[model samples]
Target: MLKTTLGQWRMFRAVVEHGGFSQAGDAIHKSQSTIHHAVQKLEDSLGIKLLQVKGRKVGLTQAGELMLRRANYLLDEAAKLEAVATGLGAGTETQLKIAVDEVFPQNLLYRVLDTVSAQFPLLRIELMETVLSGAQELLEKARVDIALSPVPLANGFNEEFCQIEFLAVASPQHALHQQTQALSYEDLKSHRQIVVRDSASNSGKDVGWLGADQRWTVSHVRTSIDMISQGFGYAWLPVPAIEQELQSGLLKPLPLTQGVKRTAQLYLCFADGDRLGPAARTFIGEVRYQSESLLTAEQLSDSN
Candidate 1:
């Protein structure tokens, strides 16, 4: 029976990518002798000559080429198995993998994490910040236990939680800030703006202030905030995301003659609602309970 395993497959792939044992060893941070021994053992176990050695160079034999293909497939399958096991183990610890919209506040997320961890010390928490579409994809694929997304639930996933307000923000120095009345949606057309691009291919519409010309379009909210902070352009940000900036006098809300407010519904989405574990249920509860109050307070402070 072949004694070859995933590690040997990695060694084989490395040698092929790097061209020789010495180069592969250097690339993988192993000694040349160790790589040579591993390949030899793998070949011996399989009873096949995998390499043709020439003066100072090595080439793959027909068997080696075939083995390389199989090795890659094996490695990919092994990686998938590892990911599944890790996710399962995490579930047992009351751990949850959550994908959130990029515009959500980092501190608010940490607060929820802290509360959960304090309540369940053994809980494992994994948070991924992505666009609403990506978050939706993670939920649909069952890769994440829960997702906090701005997009509503029309795409078929169940919504377990939601929030109902949005904020339009700009640098304090922006021309729109000089308007004496509440800002209208049409007023946004006059200013240059930065916007978050939907990462998922099927996301039909763009969120926020979109113009015919996009000087800066980014996939991350953090990058948009950074650019806005630098005065590159104005953007409509979630209230929770720009609370501190507004409070610090770094940003100001534009006033319009006709009030133009947007109500963004934040949803907690899951692939199979019936299959949610205790950890996922608890985390979802925490998020639902906290989102409204947190967003309201931040928005109130920003308006002040």
Candidate 2:
């Protein structure tokens, strides 16, 4: 059996990347002959002509192209393996399971995740989208390493993260909007309320007004918004989720004489925030960076 080493593959990759043995030698600080010898040994072990001389440059043979493509990924994973090892040596966790409130804007969440994923490509991420107090429950049960919750837990480290605007809205054609005067809390109590159910396993407490004579409870915020759009009921909806709806005048904000529309304060709570590992810390940083944009509400039709 031919002995093929990581050093041989690395030298082969450098040659492919630099386009020639001499150039690869210049880049890796080795003699041109040494680079050529290592790649030649790699080709011999694999029984293939990995490179061919094309003018003053080197071109990958068909077999060489395939091997090189695989080598790139192999090298990436090797580098990641070392990163993970070094992180482990420095007390960094290899994986982090997180639960975030679904009320948080998905676009913002995706951006934060994208940034953090690049920072720790090898770190395993287990993300759970929760509603209301679901994230709190997950953390309580030790089911997640980190959590972003709208409600603060009685214990542990809790810090204000961001606020999401919740507009009291109804379809223009709805009965509530037909009134000429602004609404009172009593006025809303008479109309049907569209409510999003909590995602917690233990059943979470209902938020906002539950005193409506008629109410509809659904599992997701989208469903509640859909019902509101259909003129079935009125509910407080996130401005970001209904940006298109608000712009198109499909959903109009209800004017409240008393409380008006609201914003919920979401918090970053960790079981042990200070003692978190590098992976968790990096995730928190990414979240904080992307969250600022989400806090600034998308322009609604009018704050009436």
Segments of candidate 1 deviating more than 4 angstroms: 1-95, 152-157, 177-190, 201-204, 292-304
lDDT of 1 at 66: 92
Task: Give the per-residue lDDT of model 2 (tens digit) for 1-304.
Answer: 5478777888898988898988999998999899889988888778889999999999999999998888877886676577556666777576788999878888888887787788888878899988999999898766887889997877677879888888889999998889999889899888999988899877858988778998888988888888899899999888778888899988999978865578998899876554467779988888887776444433332443
Backbone clash count for every predicted candidate, in the order shown = 5, 0
User: What is the alpha-carbon lDDT of model 2 when measured against the actual structure?
Assistant: 0.83
Pairs in steric clash, model 1: 181-256, 182-255, 182-256, 183-255, 183-256
lDDT by residue for model 1 over 38-70, one digit each (tens)? 899888888999988867778899999998888
Best by lDDT: 2
Candidate 2: stretches off by over 4 Å = 1-92, 293-304
